[model samples]
Target: MATAAGFEGTLAALPEAKRELARLMLAARQPVPAHPAPRSGAGPVPPTALQARLWRRERTHPAVATGSHALRLTGPLDTRRLRDALTGVLRRHEALRTRLTGSTAGRPLLEVDEEPVLRFTEADLSGFTPQAAAARTALQITESASTVLDLESGRTSAFRLLRTAPDEHVLILASHLAVFDGWSSGVFLADLAAGYREGTGHLPPPELQFPDYAAWQHRWLDGPDGSAELACRRAVFASDPRARRAAGGFERGHLPVRLARGPVARGLELGAAEGATPFMTLLAALGVVLARREGRTAVVIGTPAAGRFAGALEGAVGQFTTVVPIRLDLTGGPTFRELLHRTRAAVADALGHQRLPVDVLFSDGTPPPYDVLFALHNYPAVPLDLPGIEVGQLPGPPARHLELYSPDPAAALACVGLVERDGEIGGTAEYNRHAAAPEDVRGLLTGIEEVLDRAHTAPASPLTPRH
Candidate 1:
């Protein structure tokens, strides 16, 4: 059997900062997986459409790390135990330990490492006041997110544990979108808690790894480009005025959308009925809001579809969410119930025809195909059941694939993300700094909630909100 002393060479070679963790590693005698996975999984790592787009951006701005999830955790101090838990979690999930490499084929590929290279950075904020420490905590988060996760160099995830005082700490968990998605974040927390409680070797390996999903997606998308399956795609979206592709592409007369300032975030909570499906009513409300904002009876907005259409992928952590266009018409001022009925039907069609990647669906569209995108976080509220450590989600800014848009309105969409958590529905309205004003998004967010409330009360009447 392998012993802790056997790991001393590996741990000693680590930077001096991780030396304390070295002690923890030796003392705990945490066993590695009884069945260590192969150094690399079979087949080429499937390049997800979302990753393709994000990778393109990363090639230019390697520092543009997007997903920084932090927790405002306060509890007893057990540094050694926590370090073991972190490594244990990394060892459990292949997705968390996988790296990305861009090939001349112009797509980023994945490589699963035999073991996780954990980098845990710690800071003692003992001297600073609570207020100053809070400021410094924000700076640390920014610094943690400043550098992109370079997979070719063999890294994708990072940890920042700051001790504000003896029993309190701020934990910032981060990962690049290349492999991590919003749902994957929750999965990581659940797995972290599990690995912390039980030995890493005890946990069952995932029935399906992310690479499996990637390979499946590759074969699914590699089929004929034009098929009868997508016949309904173009027809269902015919309600939009811009459905007809103009000759010579989009008209040059369109003006660039400008944000009055850099993107700012706003939050709101509106009641939702338990009977209503996750995003059906919420997205229906957004459709109504967009129509009101543009003064157009016909509106088109993009919403995310979890793409976990398969049972095998429910627990896997990866980039499986994709966006699809949903068109709604408020013509003749239909009743709220009537609008929802229409919204449900349109959304159902979108979901049914969403097999094509979002990028592929809109790559050929003129004027970028959509002006606004909505993400209803139908996320599982997985709690971190760590002993003595009260781990809660750090909800800030917003989480959405909206960043994929270009700065020009003619090319990108304004993205808004919403979630219903703990009996309250709230989230951030994120707009591009160059295309749309933050203040406009704030007003739009408020207006959206108002419409949602009105819909809940008066589903039979036209959706014209009373001031």
Candidate 2:
């Protein structure tokens, strides 16, 4: 087992300034203790803190937290085999069979069904004209994507197979965000394909299911390490301003932005030169932009982290994404390089203590300190490769939801999701229109781009905030 000396030795390689910064920031926190081992049982377990939060939000907005994907498969397809594969996948992951039970002391609990029931639906539009069939298929996809799941009834996911032609088909997979996360989609697709190509019996059972993780998480939270982590997080956010300045209704607006390969490559090179990753570079730029807009030295932004730190969690299909708040203090005017370093340290500290759930961290029923969310998705890209069929993802409707995991539009003033694909960085900025005007959001994006360009071209130059 690794000791604190080992951790210190690893930190010794970093620059003196960064090492000192990390040491100071993490000095008060205690080392994480071993969590209780997960045991298999059929009893009701307390939902994870994040899941409980989503469950509360679901009371007002039905299906607002649903995540869906549409895929167009063209070629010889086996409908019966696909249905059986779906059933097999459902049986393999307990999250698909989970339901919300009665509240225990104002917190919702989860119960997993012993037998998995596949909620599969099929529609045939092969008799209609080609164009008409396509339109009908699209409509069905949209409906399935928006349909609300009866969480109390243990119906959390819905699947539909639309046969547009004798050789073409559309598959829709939708599930509640409480049980399913972005990472789970890839796992589901990979398992489905495997079950389709081979037999379900050939697939080995997962070492631990989602419920096991949930139960273990609860036990861990009530332990010594969990309490220390929660206290450490509270201290970090204690200095944050409590004023809810941004006033916004629940309506959302979206603006798409793209940077060509040239700039993205240059930005990556700049980050590499500074011993920073792409996310650190972007986060530093975003901090400068927010500081300029808000006219404050302190900046707080929320970013999601994949919570699957344990190797046992890598294959589990469940909600393992946790949002962490990265707070930066730009007290003195610093160059982009300096800001990047600060961001690197802050991100390291935040991620080091990321196991503390957001709901428990901010359980006062008041809004969180940050109003902006910055996400750089680097999820594993698992292709939907079947035996002989051509699989391609079909674009769905524009997402107006501001929050990434929940349907609550007022969760953030502006949410920026960036993805680097095909040598370019492109993403959408979903903002609450009632709080920020479209032009303002557009200008914010423009400022981020300019900051990145400056950092790439001249990283040593000071980050001058526009008044």
Candidate 3:
């Protein structure tokens, strides 16, 4: 037997070949499993054709694990009333409880074979104080554990409500983004409130179920030239050199800046008088932020555009987002309108090249090194009203984990997620912690907002607002 440090001493003395031999010997000594991965009920047969394709693709890349955003609220409410209301929400949304499985060859995918049941349980707070119980329950949910509520003490909650208040009464909920996006959050909240009312006998059933959207997506994504669109997508995705590499040295992932918080200074919008488009306004605002931060007049910003140019893929879920490069150059102390024009032209160029993949582009040639990544999402429509319950909207959840991890702060990118709602546009700026500090990130957004306010609030004509 080797002494505590004997192995290290022996290895240092031996030739590299001998060292390799010892490592192989140790590995061979370890037992190997005879089998892996258990197969169960063959779960939900692909209910729709689109789902079939997803199941096949996911066979190789298992659907990314789902995560939840939780909220805690304290209020005086009825338990039976809440449980009944929840059942209604669960029954309405099919994607909420869906799961998937497929063969090694990646066909004959399975889905809807078994409906994942709705989970509604209570916690026991018999011994601990109310606050303690609430704290325990919060941790339990955060750590992905199921808990039973002690209804007797006021420990009742749902995993689907988006917002909550804690103190005398609390309501909590969790949602998986795999089936929901930012746009859907607003709709879900509207419906939940309506659903609650219906549950308490305030109204009738909802006009439609989530499955309706599923059916619509199937028809929409499978429409004509959808294959062509995908071909173009392949082209774009294949263009990037870094994305094309067989391996990357970066660690799998470790999330820094876990939660980003700050007031959202007002956002930018195209006024009725101006012939400005939302994309143009967005690019202009971001250009200001970039210019302010880098102390450079000309800036390059990269944003992801939904490549679903064809209406067919409109409802087709899955990650159809593409990274498009937007370039904004300020020349001769350009006026706000001139700045806007430059921004718009850059956006057009990006959209034109959106078909090319980032990996392919990098492989062919490197992008001018500078600026940031700007992603704008025009997500699909989801139902906003359920038959019962009052739903509330909360701050978007912070992404705790990212797989495409990088330690190099200036590794040539920063992503800003922007979404336009009604007429107001709001978004979050995501940057590598190693590259951008929280204060710096906040300042960047503020600069954008300041410019937008300056432009929009100024005399409706060419007059700029007082900053």
Top model by lDDT, which number?
2
lDDT of 1 by residue, 403-442 (tens): 5432223344356666655555555665555455556676
TM-score of 3: 0.52
- Residue-wise lDDT of candidate 3 within 1-467, one digit each (tens)? 77737866776677765664554344334342221111111222222343333233333433222334443333444556666666554545444445444435453422331223446555544356666765665665554323332111122223533122332333445443334444444444545555555563543333432333333333333434333554554454343223111123222221222111221223233422245565676567767766665566666656656544444334322323345555567656666666666666677767765433343333234332343665556655443342232323334334422221111223543455566565445566555555445676666666766666666555234422223
TM-score of each: 0.76, 0.88, 0.52
Instruction: Give the distance in Å from residue 132's predicted Cα in candidate 3 to where it truly belongs.
Output: 4.2
Task: Report clash pairs, candidate 1.
Answer: 257-435, 259-436, 259-437
lDDT of each: 0.63, 0.77, 0.44
Superposed by TM-score, candidate 3 places the C-alpha of residue 448 at a distance from the truth, in angstroms, of 3.6
Task: Compute the lDDT of residue 89 as modeled in candidate 1.
Answer: 70
Candidate numbers sorted by lDDT from highest down: 2, 1, 3
The model with the greater lDDT, 2 or 3, is 2
- Backbone clash count for every predicted candidate, in the order shown: 3, 0, 50
**Model 2 spans with C-alpha error above 4 angstroms:** 1-36, 103-107, 243-248, 260-262, 398-411
Q: Weakest 10 consecutive residues, lDDT, candidate 3?
A: 33-42
- lDDT comparing candidate 2 with the true structure: 0.77
Pairwise TM-score winner, candidates 1 and 3: 1
Which stretch of 10 consecutive residues in model 2 shows the poorest summed lDDT? Answer: 27-36
